[model samples]
Target: MNNKEIVAQAVYEVVEEQLTLAEVERLLENPKSVDHGDVAFPAFSLAKVFRKAPQQIAAELAEKINPDAFEKIEVVGPYLNFFMKKEVISSMVLKEIAKEDQSFGDSNIGNEGNVTIDMSSPNIAKPISMGHLRSTVIGNSISLILSKIGYNPIKINHLGDWGTQFGKLIVAYKKWGSEEKVKAEPINELLRLYVEFHERAEEEPELNDEARAWFKKLEDNDEEALSLWKWFRSESLKEFNKIYGMLEIDFDSFNGEAFYNDKMDEVVTLLEEKHLLQTNEGAEIVDLEKYGLNPALIKKSDGATLYITRDLAAALYRKREYNFVKSLYVVGNEQSGHFKQLKAVIKELGFDWSDEMVHVPFGLITKDGKKLSTRKGKIVLLEEVLNEAKDSALAQIEAKNPDLPNKEEIANQVGVGAVVFHDLKNDRLNNFDFSLEEVVRFEGETGPYVQYTHARAMTVLGKADFTVDPEAVYALNDADSWEIIKLLQSYPEVVIQAAEQYEPSVIAKHSIKLAQAFNKYYAHTKILVDDEQRDARLALVHAVTVILKEDLRLLGVHAPNRM
Candidate 1:
């Protein structure tokens, strides 16, 4: 156990005489103010159980129980205040940091377990927008956090390379597209064709029927339709890869909805044999009204399968292939009803493991108080946003740190990190207004600020000539030093919490808290004092550097050493 847990266990020994260990652990709280003591236990709850006044209970307990882990224990107005040995806590924390280094927050709780996460399912023939950013980074960070805790996380891009969209793209391409322009700029040219088709279809309603017919032909494996569909998929991936490269993201599987085409037949047969499939208005559906959900449509009257059918096939295929302990679908909140129907249908198919499937939904991204829509071409391209951030970071670097080496590399890290960190710092379920200017700012709770703090810690460590001695005990009793130590000590718990809650914002917020504490300590305390003091302070700085770097890594943000 760490120092905090050790102290809590000691308190548990005394408190268990009247209450359980779980209750004692739950009651322990870190005091917000230094004068209040290191840890406080409110005796008010125990007064009701013991049939005595809270102050009397606290006073009696403080006088009777004395723990060696605490330097002093006293009663103050119905509360038991416990003071820690600052020197002991500091020495232990420094030694633990020195021992563990980058693996400080890792655990083995998820050993031998597996998780399959489906995210970044951007549609084909269109550029990725700021709207897809949440699923990409949030899913990526959750995977990283799971791996840190010893789970084998399977990352799937789950590309949206299926359905009637491709048919529309083909129709648009035949009417307005040129081979030369498409080859030169596939996504933009295709997007232009798509937008044009929608505009013209408003007048020429026959285009809608034509598009649906083309999709049916494609599903029937028509050679001409397949060729066009394959070309669109290939070109779209090229654009997607460029964006993925800029974000430093990779996926284990690109098995999109198209991959389940042949597999859907077996799933439908199983549903039919199990009596789960019902015909309603010539469409195949699973009746879920008994379970309080809308009927799940499996196949259209024209024999074309739906998204939920493909998902059902994909889920069963995943269970057979990976036997995953949990499968997470990182989709938007708009699809909550779709997932509800999906899980219900899976359960109806007699797969009790359907409970393991999770729908990790996030809110929408807006621009000028309007939802982003590619149909209207009113969306911001992710590439442009990334480039603008890079340009802003480059300008800042040129103005502030002109002599900094590898300026371009540092600019890339800071710039991309700014956009990504800004998205991650907020709760995923909360709608955020996307603004390039607000996110790229180097001050406040921005990514550049944390990166700069990390660089500052690195600078202090780099100037020190001697290495930290793990066994060397030091008295770091100042309020700032103690605060830094306390925050550093909580890094492991923060990492665990991020993984458990599937929220990368926990680590993002913790990084800002640690950075703020370190900056406050840096302004007042000098790292380079006498030889021994310098070494001890270097140890602290090194620990901060290690943690800040790892925390940012888990959030999928780069921490440059010389930003």
Candidate 2:
């Protein structure tokens, strides 16, 4: 156990007569001011249990308890404050970080557990846009968090590769698309054709019937329709792979809605067997008004399946195939109703494990306070945004250090890290405006600042040739050193909380706080001093480096050693 856990356990031993260990741990909190102490426990909740006043209870407890783990304890009004041996905590935290290195904050709490995460379900024949950024990075970071805690995470890129959209593409391709142009520039050409189809269909309303007929033919597996569909999918994937490579994202499964097409029949039959299906204007649906949701449409009047049908089939398939402990859908909050109905239908089908399924919804991206819409073509492509960030980073590097080695590689890391870190730093439930200028700034609580802090620590470590001895008396003689040590000792707890709460922003904020503390400490003290302070201060710098790197990794951002 770490120093905080040891201290908490020690406090439990002191107050075992009045409260359980869990309750004591829950009540233990970090003091806001340095003068208050390292940790504090409030006596307000225990007054009724002990049948005494809060101040009287605190004074009595302080007088009776004789704990050896802490250096001192005092009762300040209704609060019981604790102070630890500074040298002991500093030595313990530094030694633990040095021993574990990159894997310092990980735990085995989720051993042998399986998690399947669904994210980044972009439609075929359309380029990935800035709107898809939240789902992709948020899901990726959660997967990393789960894996750090020993859960086997299965990343799935559930592509949107079905529906009448493909029929519209097919109709547009035959009318205004050429084979050479499509083969040369697939996504752009397909987008042009798609845009043209909507434009012309406004005047030619019969185009809707033709599109529907083409979709029916494709569903029937017509050779001509299948050929076009396969080519579009193949070309789109090639472009998608380039983007994924740039982002360093990988998926264990690329199964999309089309993959579940043949599997949806069993769902319809099961719904019918359970008497969950109802007729609504010649359509098949599950009446969910009683459960405070709109009817879940299973099949259209024309016998075509809907999106929810495929989702239900996919959920069942994932359960039987992986038997996951948790299956998470990381999508936009606009689909909240769809997931509620999905879970309701699953529960009505007699599966009690429906609660294991989770829908992790996030807010949308906006430009100039207006929502970005892909259907109307008023969207920014993700590729362009990333490239722009890279260019800006390169320019900044040129201005700061024109002769730096491996400049291009470092620029790529800083650029991508800025964009990703900006998104992850905000609460997922709150919408954020996209601004390239603000995200890549080098000062303040930004990604480049954190990266620069790591680089600064690396430079200091390089200048010092002393060894870090955990057994030696490393005096953290100043408040700055003690502040940094306290933050370092709390890394493992912060990581665990982030994973449990499904919040990457927690880690983001923690990293920035640590960076700020270290920068202040660095400004006041010199690490390469001619004394015992050299080894002790270097040890602190090393611990800070290890923690910042791990935090960045959990947020799906890269930490560069030089910036």
> By summed lDDT, which 10 consecutive residues of candidate 2 come out lowest?
466-475
- Summed over model 2, clashes come to 0
Model 1 ranges off by over 4 Å: 2-4
Candidate 1, RMSD to the unseen true structure? 1.7
User: TM-score for all predictions?
Assistant: 0.96, 0.96
Per-residue lDDT of candidate 1, residues 30-66 (tens digit): 8787787788888888887789999998888887665
| lDDT for each candidate structure | 0.88, 0.87
lDDT of 2: 0.87
* Candidate 1: residue pairs that collide: none
Each model's backbone clash number:
0, 0
